[model samples]
Target: MHELVVTPLGERRLVLRQGSSKALQLPKARFEELRTSGSSAVPQWLADAVQARWGMDVTGRPVDDVLLLREAGPYAFSRATWELNLGCDYDCVMCYLGEKRFEGLDMDGKRKLLAVMRDAGVIWLQMTGGEPLIDPDFPKAYRIAYELGMQLEILSNGSRLHKSHILNLLRTYPPTKLTLSVYGATAETYDAVTRNRGAFHRFSRGLRMAIDAGLTLDLSLIIVRGNAHEADDMRAWASSLGLPFREYANISPTIHGGAETLPSQSPEYLTNRAPFTGCPAGVTFFHADPFGRASICKVGRDPNIDLIAEGVEGLVRLGGIAESLMLRTGGCSGCKLSGTCRVCRPMAKVFQEAKAPLENYCQHGSR
Candidate 1:
């Protein structure tokens, strides 16, 4: 009986709570509208297609909405994320990016990244680091991304957001999104994950400052095996703040140097996962590190290929990166749970390192 969310994927969906589970309820009427609307139309030639099937009119009306029919296809990749660093000030056990001490991206390094993204024709670029705000060039880098005609998203630990200069950027260039990580419900839970005593207050206060500065905000909570019970409380926290939230299962350990801290969730957790129709790794997204390495995922940084050397167009043609992501592997191909499985480069890396069959990380195929 709740309101329906008309997503860009051409689906008018509603979320219903059945017992302890939250189910996304979609109607048959909206599905038909999605098919007939010009706004929902997707380029038939593109391989990355979670949003491809939903057609729309010139003005962007979903076919399902236009025809008042049932919707089809999965709604995924509502957005894309790019990592700016593998380093973090805190050693969180669940973070797939920062289990070790890694250096932040410098100013010059970030400009090259922006240039590479523009050349790749990316419309959205996210700046993520051990904590992006920790890097002094964050504001300048965000502006460079915007100047390149790309909307920006920032994932920060919220430590440096309290600065007036940083707040000025939030008021001026204002990113399309700003995700602040809330590790725990209280300082004890937060400190446990961050391993820093006062991080909880800094993050909380910075978050409030950002919200007050008029930045579009969202939240992320990485759920380790030991912290699974925090799901309900996490959701409540997100709701209270009126932010779109996500609680991800920590699978890949944050790999930097020789440190790989894996989450407690095993392969069985994704056994019955939902089918992800396609991977948009190289098509809809391309990540560029501070050092100018262009990769499909952030965790693929160690041996990353340089975009400056290969060039964006050549990289896409030779990499065949996007195509590699669509193939299904064990547990993903025919699993009933395929509908909800979240596969990224990190998962792919683990599968490959273990030499597991059908492990498609980056959603891209093996090299």
Candidate 2:
């Protein structure tokens, strides 16, 4: 079947690809028209624009366009985040995987896992970690995923990306994007957060090299109390680079239930609560840990099933199990605070040391 892949580039721009050969960036409105009205309704100007840019022969491909547009239906699992390993070189203060032993799947095991994901219809795969680059076999695994036609992404600190071998691998089989976490604006503050001397310098050097290599890059600031003062500077630095930047404030407990990295949230910080809807974990998204244990989301990891042993079908089966568990248990059930409560079943499971209603997460008093 012909596949027309639509990927959002920015505010109103989108990149539309036909198979792996032809791709062109067009306005979102035109893409929507093509999506809803089929290829026959495609404006003559739009067709000419695509053909002029990519030199694709669209003379008698009307049927193919219609089929491709219609192919954008729901799949069992469309995207996945695989934590290649929990190992990282720098010790960041706010890291989630605290002192957790790194146990990633071997090369052969990773190949099998990728095959399972492909069979399960996952089109987008994000390779993340404490730092995915730390994995020795990451390049081979990444190449395998690229060859399998998965739109891939990597989340890293950019410390090792400047290395010749790593850069060569990235240039050879480029990922869809690379998301680098910027700890702080300056070397002092950045190294303070990382707890490693000269880490900021390494990160900056690697980031520059990656940019020079023409890798698509995005940056995020992991805002914690330590670097809260430099938030503006960090944002400004990211703006200087002209890359997309985001800030994350909410700090969850460590993935391994270790000591809390950041301090407890103030009552004022907890007061302004947004409405709680269910997260798209087991349903539409899944996170696989180093050893192939699959969870609904990274923060809401629970009832984790071994994906290596049970395979993709195991994940599918666990979705219902996870959903049922979330709906019935924890402080979420029939609680008035559910509207404003940030605590979900998985969070409750992680921080279950306290009583119900999760006073730390509730704007209202705990029940």
Candidate 3:
């Protein structure tokens, strides 16, 4: 497998090395030159640059052997997130995905889905789910994506990070980043929140193991009612680990527009966010469900494009879908506070469908 991947990112291009975080920007002209350089040996300057910057001697190797070039596409996407499966070991009441169904695309389906993503110019891929590590075929699927030349990231709950196989897989490939969610600093609050006995112990063990293994990891401090009392402890613990962390206090309704998860919102921890800026969901990136159905993003999952059946050609329709979903129509038509609204239109619509309290999403509710 090639160590470096050169891919187009909209108007610019980038050089990314697997299992590493450093990136080198390439201008369009230089990129075009390299693109036309063909399957011959790696150019001396390029090889020397890689050596000088990364200290890795990739000299005298075939261009194809040292670099994987991702051709430009109509979508201009460099980032995409895939939910491998919707199954989780923990039953956190605040899960936005209400149902923890452990069903999704099989191995054959997964390979095809990943190939479509690769061809579509997706270089940054995030593999997320209820708990991706628990999937029986996670190892195979992850390896396939990694070999496909996509920079991989993982979102997990740290419950399985202690497993030998998981540690080995991550240590070998090294995702761009592994983000683990922290529910509480104490086991009592953690188990109570997840409704899973002995979950905190498992998570703690896995976290320590992952840290000891020297894996790049970050923590997402999820503030909810069950663990609201331990918020300080959680931050202190993450600080003690010397790993970067961000706090997430605002909870959302389930994907199906169910209000079941709203009760978990920690009122005291609610934070005011900046205005809702426009996003490049479909224009530059998209989210793929487990079955290979692509949507604009996680919040706007409607009108999916079936990649398995339609292939990469289906992504052509995503741009229009994103535009339509972002419009200020329907309940938000002529809203006075459009400029300062904290949530995007699609997200506001989800909150509305869930009949969530106006204070949770609407700027007027702040009055």
Tell me, by lDDT, which candidate is best: 3
* Candidate 2 global CA lDDT score: 0.71
**How high a TM-score does candidate 2 get?**
0.77
At residue 245, what lDDT does model 2 achieve? 83
Name the regions of candidate 2 deviating beyond 4 angstroms: 1-75, 264-273, 332-334, 354-359
**Total backbone clashes of model 2?**
0
Candidate number that wins on lDDT, 1 or 3: 3
lDDT of 3 by residue, 1-367 (tens): 7789898877778888887789888888878877887777787878888987789887778887788888876567878999999999999999999998999999999999999999898888999997899999899999999988899999999888888999999998889899999999898999998889999999999999988888889999999999999999999999999999999999889899998999889989999888988988998899999999999998899989999999989999999999999998877888887888888988999998999888888867856
Q: What would the TM-scores of all predictions be?
A: 0.64, 0.77, 0.95
Candidate 1's C-alpha runs over 4 A off are 1-82, 98-101, 256-260, 263-272, 299-304, 324-349, 352-367
TM-score of 1: 0.64
Quantify how close model 3 is to the true structure by its C-alpha RMSD in Å: 1.7
1-367, model 2: which lDDT tens digit per residue? 3424444322433434422334566676766766665546446666576578666555445633522431221335667899888888888766768785678788888988888776665667899997889899888888777665567889999989878999988876667789999888999989998888988999999998888888888898887776778888999999998888877766656777754653632222223445556776787678888888888878766678887798866865657856775663554466655655655667666665333234555555534
lDDT by residue (307-365, candidate 1, tens digit) is 65665544444235544544446434554544444564345545556454453233223
Question: Could you tell me which 10 consecutive residues in candidate 3 have the lowest summed lDDT?
Answer: 69-78
